[model samples]
Target: MRATALSLASLPARPHKTADLAPGTPAAVVTAPPPRRPRGRPRKTAQERSDGNRRRQLMDGAAQLFRSKGFAATGTRDIAAAAGMHSGSPFYHFASKSALLFAVMNEGMASAVQSQQQALAVLAPQAPARECLRVLIRHHFEVLLGPRSSFIAVMLYEWRSLTPVQRRRIALVKDSYEAAWMPALTALGQQGLLQAEPGVARLFIFGALNWAVQWFAPDKGKSLDELTEQALALFIHAG
Candidate 1:
């Protein structure tokens, strides 16, 4: 239970970018950049290439199974079978179910972050900030409440299963990303565009967005677009 508690206590990982340090920069001198990983393992044998492909296939299958069923209820053989591997095959790729869970959740979270960034980019040039926020809100729901909802589910629920170190690592990334929204949101309220309390707007906005996973049903008489419109209207009214 300690493992689960740790997972619940924090988040997962993220991508990295190289700092701009030319050969002679002070930082570069102190620490020569790590050796570049060769692009592909020096021309692997045909069997090695096939094995690498199979490992990827297994991980993908495992992710899908965990999403459809809660992580705890999902067995390693279930993932192996889903990947068309022998019953014991998942063990070759994942040391334990929690490891597999971490891999799946990490991937899904990264994808979610990417999608949100892309959605916000659409509104960057032409739309007003309020309108842009509305679009961002709607698209965020599309990912969370619609077909791509599984990642958010894992993030909100299954995180408690991670190692403490892993949990802290993920939490830092998740909170940092969440913190990025504040500047824009604060600007809106400061400019008198949104009638929201600056200090509390993030909480309310996220609460509204996250709730979509429960009540949001596709083809449930109301379309997602309509739902977005209504939600935006409600927020605007309060603002």
Candidate 2:
């Protein structure tokens, strides 16, 4: 018994595995919980959230007012009231009415670019160039004449109201939106589906489509789908 005891006592102590320990055991020296990494976007503070929401509200209200009443005639107080904010609140979000106008246009163009990307992404990998153009044309119609289109309509009318710097800034985004069409147009030109040069055809196509904003009333005449087909027919040669 003495020999056995000595032999057992001399054996090295077995390290305790984490799985073997009760969660709260005092002997669990290595049981410090892992530091939790933050998940997803960092939480916005209450004030930050309120500020963002107010800014969006101001833009939306400003867009509606600018579209209905030309930018030159829409006053800051009108925008504030339309946004359900104090008369002086607009200055907190924008330096002046003109700045707000630029914001509206900039945001509108950015949204249009995102919508165009999403529309193009759903196209079949091997879609014909003419079909690609059809998708782009339909999506453009939605951006200009469909529901919640006041933002872009305001942009169409208020371009001259923006400062030179603001106009240049907006033009950058405008070019980005237009650039998406080049590949399809180029392909169509190579296929002899476009009568004019690709660059010239792009300009003519946009001019025609943007003009619809002036006379298109959803209540009267052809639906947007029918309009899209008509536009496609007018722009593309018969196959």
Candidate 3:
């Protein structure tokens, strides 16, 4: 039997004023929220399950090989072998190696955007623009330097390997991630914290953060906190 899920959070309520309560009235019962419904959709059909698993394996395996081995050197068979599928199996999911590369790049951008938005959501609603920028920078570092970073890393280094159509498709999502940062940077410009044009400033910020993939190493050098501090110091002027 499926156990009903209950919310661990309590409904917020203020203390009831005695003046507001009737003399003979019983205290109100705090009912448990009608047992919370399960969070996600119904279970996937077996074929859907199989397709989802295969697609995930292919993407994961492709990201690993593409980041470590140049796109040109990694073939469909290599991705398949890494994914534990038969040599021809990847073709079941992707038309060609180029198509697989595009999927990896697309997924990387989508994931990065999702993560950045979530990080911003947790900040206080009225967070200062500089504080928001700091969170943005820190989030970029996490995406670029954290575990499973190969997808974005692949997107960074193998961009030229994509065909024109593939490039166009990836850029659509990439632009949104950039869009998310622009408003905060524009606010900084208004506050005189930024010296360069806001658009150019955005480019410079991304350039600096993305370059960490090339040189920043957790074992050998600065941690994300140090990088975040140094980056803010470089980009934002102290008043």
TM-scores for all predictions:
0.69, 0.77, 0.77
Of the candidates numbered 1 and 3, which has the greater lDDT value?
A: 3
Q: lDDT of each structure?
A: 0.63, 0.79, 0.78
lDDT of 2 at 215: 90
> Model 3 clash tally?
0
lDDT at position 41, candidate 1: 55
Separately for all candidates shown, the number of backbone clashes (residues 3 or more apart, or on different chains) is 9, 0, 0
Which candidate, 1 or 2, would have the higher lDDT against the true structure?
Answer: 2
- Write the residue-wise lDDT of candidate 1 on 36-148 in tens digits: 54565554443333434555566577666665676777888887787777887566656566656665666556666677788777665766657766777777777777765
Q: Distance (Å) between predicted and true CA of 208, model 1?
A: 2.3
Deviating ranges (above 4 Å) for candidate 1: 1-60, 193-196
What's the candidate order when arranged by decreasing lDDT? 2, 3, 1
Stretches of model 3 off by over 4 angstroms after superposition = 1-51
The segments of candidate 2 whose C-alpha lies over 4 angstroms from its true place after superposition are 1-51
Q: Using alpha carbons, what is the TM-score of model 1?
A: 0.69
